[model samples]
Target chain A: MRYSGFQVIKEALTGHKGWKPVWRDPEPQSHYDIIIIGGGGHGLATAYYLAKEFGEKKIAVLEKGWIGGGNVGRNTTIIRSNYLLDGNEPFYEMSLKLWEGLEQDFNYNAMVSQRGILNLIHSDAQRDAFTRRGNAMMLNGADAEMLSTEQILDRYPFLNVNDARFPIKGGLAQHRGGTVRHDAVAWGYARGADMRGVDIIQNCEVTGFRLENGKCLGVETSRGFIGANKVGCAVAGSSSRLMSKADMQLPMESHVLQAFVSEGLKPVIPGVITFGAGHFYCSQSDKGGLVFGGDLDGYNSYAQRGNMPVVEDVCESGMALMPMLGRARLLRMWGGIMDMSMDGSPIIDKTHIDGLYFNGGWCYGGFKATPASGFCFAHLLSRDAPHPNATEFRFDRFSRGLMIDEKGMGNQPNLH
Target chain B: MIINHPLLGPRDAAEFTYLGDASLINRPDWQSETAAQDFYEYGYLRSNPAGIHRELWFHEAGDRSWLVVTRNTVTHEISNVEMARDVARTQGRSK
Candidate 1:
């Protein structure tokens, strides 16, 4: 798990290595000016940005578990901004930009390798859709390349190469898109923020909140009560539960997403690849293991355990796409709860409550959006207004039919 | 054969369904059964179950958590077609 810079970069190129935490707080703090109720990537990123942007110290990130213990630590770390939806496109593009400059910005090695992500096209319809998406990326100054079947095979000789069921007609490759160390992102932001006087309270769960005159005064945690001028709930899985205490209902649902890793072998996959026809996606880890994941567990459950059907489905897709992986033994599998929004996008907006802010509903692709989401959420929290790109991601959009329904899958809780 | 259930579409139309303990719909009446037989003889149910078989389905249970259905075409044999809830419940148990 612990990777050096060279190993991290190399593993990132192959989609193989993950970040091992290098720092931990020796003592936990009791209070802060701002109490963020999750230690995932978003919470840590928000803390880092809050300290960096507002110079507001005494910020405490209270987590029921360790840093990166939530979806931040358990995600397919493929980073890209190839969004076609209006509201999400620009915001994700900003995240991609931050990914490009992350190492220099944080002075921490995130191992953000721009190895390119290829969204394979299975048919002419898919190709046309990808064309529109590629054009949009180009218009937004993001790098994208449309490739033919020959080009795909030439670049990736290890693929099955041909199959009538799901032919590899072509694909859209974002040259600037790739994978990163998911845990390192959380730690990097946490370390950077901690150095700026933010208190990261691990193993400290926020049990409830204290509201005074329609405003969030502070929170009551397992450790004790802590007062804060502003409180942001960045807890991805527990967003609705926390918000419900304030008589607010988020257009959010908590669903489980599962990921798996195959036993280590010599690296074969060179970049992150997604099968548009199937739910499977994969990138080789730094240690030569195949790291991959599939769609969310179709049913609702707070339990972080996934069933065999999805594992079988994803593995079958992987085997069909890469026949060589048939012999690769799956070493382990894990699941994390995701706050899937109705629109499959995040909600970075202030609630009707005066001091209560929210940054959640990341669905499954939150790892890549961490930096930008935090930056935008921090801006909103500080200014009490929406960020430029996130203006349409308001909490009230659902009521006004302004939902950003990406993937053309309406704002259904189970669709994402 | 395409077995058409009331709640669910044709059998093939269903991605997968759950089999349950009891039926939700009653058997067809005499006239409807005769018509169904005629349709089945004409390759309606023979080719696609959706043409003749009337299946009882319980929506809102299973993997997709929609419904349970039962369909029959020839002898009118009814059987449940839904993901086993116990299996899902067992699978959902935390490790």
Candidate 2:
């Protein structure tokens, strides 16, 4: 049902029995025209756009677990388009635009809050780098404002300005960048796709792919063998393992990136604030909890839990940025496997195996790229070509020496 | 998590930088005819096993030495840790 204020008021006036489940739980069928593995935000969004925009039918999204159980739900929920690389800035800008209209387009309340994001600058070198990044962002059609320390202090007074080690000199602010309710995105896309006749089969783990004679046919799942003419793998951190079934090794590794939310407190942080001297970013959730995260656990693992040193280091950075956070009690923390690529970018291209398409290596930035990743991936699957904005994200970029090294980390997945 | 360093006793795992598959130390000959393909394979591909794995860890903050760590990815348990220089020397790696 289309969610609206009228429906809510009508249901409130009535017995509130008019509401239905957000999406249906449908069983699988024998065959489908297209099958999308991993029903996270990307997979569900691909199915949604394929049906809603591309007019493709007979689509099925097979999820090993329930929806919103992966990195889609385990992120800090920040969204921004402030990228430096030409190959990445435009695509992320497209995603930011899509996020601007997501709640209305899907008729779901995703809580897309555009409060703004401030990447705090601490030194002269960082200021120059941020200035270049801001120019790049503005050139790519995304809003970016260079705010002085006074302007940042005017907005966020809680930031530690007296710190001598890493003083906040300035900040690169994106007024359009902010956070959203992470799980609601997965739910909205899943509901949208289910309404458009896309069968979303949960608990259907793909055991192997049906590869014969260098051509793909279908997948062997825990439920049974399901046949599909075309198959797209949007599995985020599990890309290496999932593609290994088809005997394809990806140019990526999985590392655990953890996120944390503090106990409920009064509204403090007006928007997302990232520490420049270290890897820590935080924002106040609508529920009054401080949501934040930092670097990965620096290891190759598929496990969903992280170690403690990263947590200590993250809190150290937070306390360094805002000394008052030392008083706030830690509520809880969780980890999600990030598919870190060599250049810290993503890969959305067709594989040598016919009828198989792969989309992964999103690292910690996957949550923000949900809309555009899906739209571009759907474009690729439907038209057999990459979208104009996403043409740089190819599997051959590394081999051809066209790698989009965003962090300039040079083939280091963890560093990125 | 604490990784028992071979020379430095117990140290936090956060001080170490992870590089997957200890086999990367055995770099292919740069002058070989298939050097491009070999480097491509060396740069990208991985076994990425779910169980025990032999990996490389750099002590970036402490000794500035690389360590060969055999750890279990599933259980987050370290089975063995050795100096990567020693491991490379044993493998007859020069320069």
Candidate 3:
């Protein structure tokens, strides 16, 4: 069933009578080809690709919450491939490519609007850094352009042309980067994968790992024990906890990142804009509200509720960038738990255990990289060989001192 | 008086030093300064202000303790201003 945006809404309204979940084996199948823990974007996408690419139809994706109820649903859905490090550039570009063709591929209107993303430069140092990054993107065959102040103004006239504190310099505009409907992307993958006979189990939390002689055999969830030959851990927030239950620790910190939406207004902002000096970026939602977010609350917190500091900081920066937002009241605010890795890059590799695979450490950029991450992760899981682009993002890179420290920011929660 | 310089740029001098805490310098606003001072005196607050840059000191180690600072570049102001040791002690006591 190739469903579009309207069709999906209609189906939801009319009730999915014909659709039966493939994961519900009445007799309870003893095992599956692959078991994907966590039904977020990464896990669902992985399941989708496993069935679509490798022809592994007996795949199961188990989620603790309803589909699209995790960070995949909470994130500010911005997509970009303007990574600075060598290790991340190619893979993110691949993700960007997947994002480009996602709507057509899923037959779902993800609203993947490539309105372009502009990372504003504040200092001369920042300008040089963006220049280098833009050059790298160009060398890697990704679309990126450096815009001047006049060019920026010509493009986004609503922005403050003269702000003294952080003067408006040009930005690194990735033409391919943009925003998508966060929830729609998740539902699209769920509907698409479910159509291809993949079982998506919700309200099923993995309590423990079924290990036999140091190898993951299956998962013990709240629902029941499900056996699997291969198990993939795509759980983001609970990655550390799950791995610890298996007596392992990946270099990850769970932090709460918050996002805010302003009162609905006529759309003024066209593309996504990120501030270099300040931890803030915003995009206009289809409903005309200005959706934006800033740095994570600087403490180890699994609680999804963020403090007022981040919200105030984001709003202040928004006012600085576009003064018109001063009068615009904030409509709502929300938070998501991000698994911030030490290197700020994701880990897609076979774990120390033979059959157990892990895919996490997405930081705040997981929503946009859903397709590419899923594809590469699926390829790695199916072939037992890491994709060429994501080879450096191995779990052992931390011990080896080969960390891909993009943004020149350290792995510490406070810094990230 | 609004001092406008090329490097540091223009800012209202009246709004320079915070109103509540004179020990702390360059607080974002009166409300924030009061909040910080309230936290400092009482050792806790329901919530902390977001997105402000602040300079603080820690005094547990000695008469002059480690300075703790949190600031936001966009606002060009301090969000938190308190002693690191004080914060640690407060948090430790709470826990």
What are the RMSD figures for all models against the true structure?
12.3, 1.4, 11.2
What does candidate 2's lDDT look like per residue over B3-36, in tens digits? 8999999998878778778989989999999999
Question: What is the docking quality class of candidate 1?
Answer: incorrect
* Backbone N/Cα/C clashes per model: 27, 0, 11
Clashes of 3: 11
Model 1 lDDT tens row, A347-369: 88888888889998888878889
Candidate 3: which stretches are off by over 4 Å?
Answer: A4-28, B1-95
In model 2, the runs with Cα more than 4 Å from the true position are: B6-10, B60-64
Candidate 1 chain A worst ten-residue window by lDDT? A17-26
Q: Candidate 1 vs candidate 3: which has greater lDDT?
A: 3
- What are the chain A TM-scores for all the models, listed individually? 0.93, 0.99, 0.94
lDDT for each residue of candidate 2 in A178-285, tens digit (9 for 90 to 100): 999999999999999999999999999999999988888999999999999999999999898899999888888888899999999899899899999999999999
DockQ of 2: 0.67
lDDT of 3 at A170: 81
**Residue A301 alpha-carbon offset, candidate 1, angstroms:** 1.2
Per-residue lDDT value at A48 in model 2: 98
Question: How close is candidate 1 at the interface, in terms of C-alpha RMSD after superposing the true interface residues?
Answer: 18.9
- What fraction of the correct interface contacts does each predicted structure contain? 0.00, 0.62, 0.00
lDDT against the true structure, each candidate: 0.75, 0.92, 0.76
Please name the candidate that would achieve the greatest lDDT relative to the true structure: 2
